[model samples]
Target chain A: MFTGLSAFPLTPIDEKGIDKRAFVGLVTRLADAGVDSIGALGSTGGYAYLSREQRAWAARTAVEAAGTTPVIVGIGALRTRDVLNLAADAQSAGAAAVLLAPMTYQPLTDDEVFGLYEAVTAEISVPLVVYDNPGTTHVTFSDELHGRIAVLPKIGSIKIPGIAVEEAPGRIAVLRAVIPAHVTIGVSGDWLAAGGLLGGADAWYSVLAGLFPETVLAITRAAQTGSSAAAVAASDRLEPLWALFQRYGSLRVVSAAAESLGLVNSPNLPLPLLGLDHAARRELEAALVVLGLN
Target chain B: MFTGLSAFPLTPIDEKGIDKRAFVGLVTRLADAGVDSIGALGSTGGYAYLSREQRAWAARTAVEAAGTTPVIVGIGALRTRDVLNLAADAQSAGAAAVLLAPMTYQPLTDDEVFGLYEAVTAEISVPLVVYDNPGTTHVTFSDELHGRIAVLPKIGSIKIPGIAVEEAPGRIAVLRAVIPAHVTIGVSGDWLAAGGLLGGADAWYSVLAGLFPETVLAITRAAQTGSSAAAVAASDRLEPLWALFQRYGSLRVVSAAAESLGLVNSPNLPLPLLGLDHAARRELEAALVVLGLN
Candidate 1:
């Protein structure tokens, strides 16, 4: 099930808490778009910024709104205990799988990271995706570590960060050689999604697909069908938006795009992470207009 | 009040939550040693792995145990709202000041980081200490950014990570030039505490001080009194222990030492953060005995 496009939607949270209405709309929209799966509460979902109650509600809500589309709920938290609790909540809420990242405050050791996966995988009933997002979690998984953890029960997928285009095949090959055959590889970082998918990644765990499902799905379908040129061309068409994502981070830039597109209320992000400034917002809007996304 | 030896004790916790008796004992020991201040809930205190309620209880317990000793509670959380709430709880619990690190899961921007300080400073009743431990927090503050935050009201201190012995003076000088005069600088990284203090830092935020206050206070005093050789000699005496800290992080090593000393129960750390392995613990015990710290 961890194949093709896994759209990661923003939770649309603010000072009051999860923007349930906007969130349901985002999820329902993804379900309608026929993406392979919905990854609610991933990095783009801002799981780290939310409370467990809020996150559980998000998991249930995303599952409900996604209809028949499989919803993979991200249950990453600073504590192993909280992650277990969240996994139970996600499973109870009828999630297809639970995405777990080794989130840290006091930088975790390799053994500690392994212990996290070991402890969680032991209790969780659902298939667990290993979220190797170093950009946010700061816990990088060496392939040796990945190999060790992959043999654990219920380990379904491995979500790797985007590798440079030229390095994607070799990186994916190295990772693939370690994990079990059934454990699919999902690539994140929307700008590099096309190359990663073409380079033999089984799925694209995407930020852009959350808001612009059809847009990224075009690239995904093209890549999956072996039309690499079309996939690259489709991705190239949104170069301007990707540039903005690169400059200001996909979360902030996507929030700006969502706000500008009037899909959600202004200041949609959680605090300390304000929406982009006026100049950056203008740049984002200009990019959207250039890409005909607006 | 922010100057001198600031001891950050481990918040002896396991699955059952904060060991109130052991925690109070640690706090009382620091107070009895006449350390300059008690930094409750700092990284060594495992504030990140704890719930806000647990942290509030820790703040109150530490304050009660410390008697007249001022307690600075760490109030870092992933969200600004949570950070604000933690700060309020800390202040209500009678914390002398709130220590905050830009604890990120989604890497924050310069503007967002500055905005975090701006929003937090405006709300907290207690003075705020900027915790700059990139080793734990993963958020590195620029001198320009430090200068920007220092100008804000209620900014009391900056806790910098340790530097190389030779580079300490130049590094401190560069940092001192950027921030305001009144905001004191406290140096962390126990092994480098002597160098940092001798380099003209106002305080030593020593992890060792949390467990063995007298051991570190001797070094701090010698450095503060301009006895450079004495301070270096005192630090040098603990070279074996420092080497262990360098090999396996200070937190794990210190926890092992604390448990070995019968100060806390074994496996005192939060889940996912296992105690040092048998070999590492043996190494730590050997080092402690060598330094006569056991």
Candidate 2:
């Protein structure tokens, strides 16, 4: 019965380390915007870059800001032990669920993939979501693979990126046909929000929710109430920002947007990823202003 | 100065976990092939797929088999702390140097990349090799960035993959000109051996060395002695297997070749990576036989 918009808030960091006050403020704003859930340590949150201590702090801040709302902690890492450690830390932070992606470096076998989930789920008491974002990680959870993973005892949901946006509905249908009714299917693309809703996605995962929470919430509300016209209108208004996300990729665009919104001090990405170019930054800033967010 | 051929030996896993006997045997065979050094836990050795305990055991086995020769341990991971821990373990296991790939997963900034190396080198006592393999890790070390990292204490070498074969000479030249003369540059990819040597690479990071150590040693010795005819003869003999490595990709081709030579019991890969198809297996087997390796 998970529905509506979920915000993936950026984990703020400065030279000294995790900026807890800034993180708490961002989460408070997200919750005030009517976000149904907050997903911390997601790619937009720079989960891969943060130290274990930073991840725990971000998860705690999200839960504290959420008050009664659920918090889903991202536990994606190359090592299963690290994932399990994060999962346990999330539980200690009172997160309602854990969102996990498979090991990023080595392409795992189907059995090893299953074992990864099984091992992680075995360590934590919280509900688990099999987060499938193959573009960043270079690994995909096929519909067949999803079917097999769905049967795990605590696997309550899936956060699938619409890599093939057009075929998302068919993919959703295939997943829905396999998973039990209790397990919710969530789509992770802004463009596919309308289609994901019409195709029976229970909720939408929005990176935009970090900077434009109210707008994302409004869209989800309209979609849930079956107000197709209102939903389309919201989607149209947000399409420009989504286009920006598509341009430089979500992780970079979302981080930049978060910085503009004053949710975080700087878009400090870890090693290997450069900051946005001047043109991309100006483009993002213009989009934010257009959306009345900057 | 580092020279000759290095073998990245596969870690053996059985029902009881890491098969020490199998691993020891594999390393012993590589030693018999007269490999200059033994590399443990690399992509070909399934390093990322291993648990920390398994990795430690593999390192220990490699050290034991290596005897007087050096054992280079792969210490790359998603988390900085884990990499540090692995480096410490590797040093204790008597590994002569640690091969560190910059943080995997998300793209990183140059500062953060430098921070990772600085942190590893600060705590670990052994020499470190900066491994730049963008194909697997999705990150590359630019010459400018390499120049910055090279200044760090204990950073004694670099291992650059030969996919960018043409670019090897320029990179090696830059490193040789900038870094200390003692810091050797090792080249990966069998086909790039001649080019790499001509480009001033000091050593061959040879996967083929796992199967044909003598061949690799002969080629390197010939190249060092300025015997072009002998070097070409060796390269021609091993060219088919190297071509197969390029076609099927290094990890798959190496594992398939090892299985064909009865070095590894199974051609099993961890989750997400499908094993070689029958046609690929046949081609690999034929290539190995052609090279007189099987």
Give the top-scoring candidate (DockQ): 1
lDDT of 2 at B179: 74
Candidate 1: interface RMSD equals 0.8
**CAPRI accuracy category, model 1:** high
lDDT of 1 at A179: 89
Candidate 1 clashing pairs, residues 3+ apart or interchain = none
DockQ for every prediction shown: 0.87, 0.27
Per-residue CA lDDT of model 1 for B1-294, tens digit only, reads: 889999999999888777788998999999999999999999999999999899989998998999999999999988999999998999899999999999888888878899999999999878999999888778878899999999999999999998988999999999999988999999988888899988889998888899999999998889989999999999999998899888888898889999999999987999899899999988888888888888
Q: Mind giving the per-residue lDDT tens digits that candidate 2 earns over A158-241?
A: 888763546766877888999988889988877667667756788888787876788788888888888878887878887777
Consecutive 10-residue window with the lowest summed lDDT within model 2 chain B? B266-275
Native contacts present in each candidate (fraction): 0.87, 0.30
Q: Which stretches of candidate 2 lie over 4 Å from their true place?
A: A51-57, A118-125, A163-168, A191-195, A267-283, B10-34, B38-41, B44-98, B108-130, B140-158, B162-185, B190-202, B208-212, B222-294
Q: List lDDT for all candidates, in order.
A: 0.91, 0.77
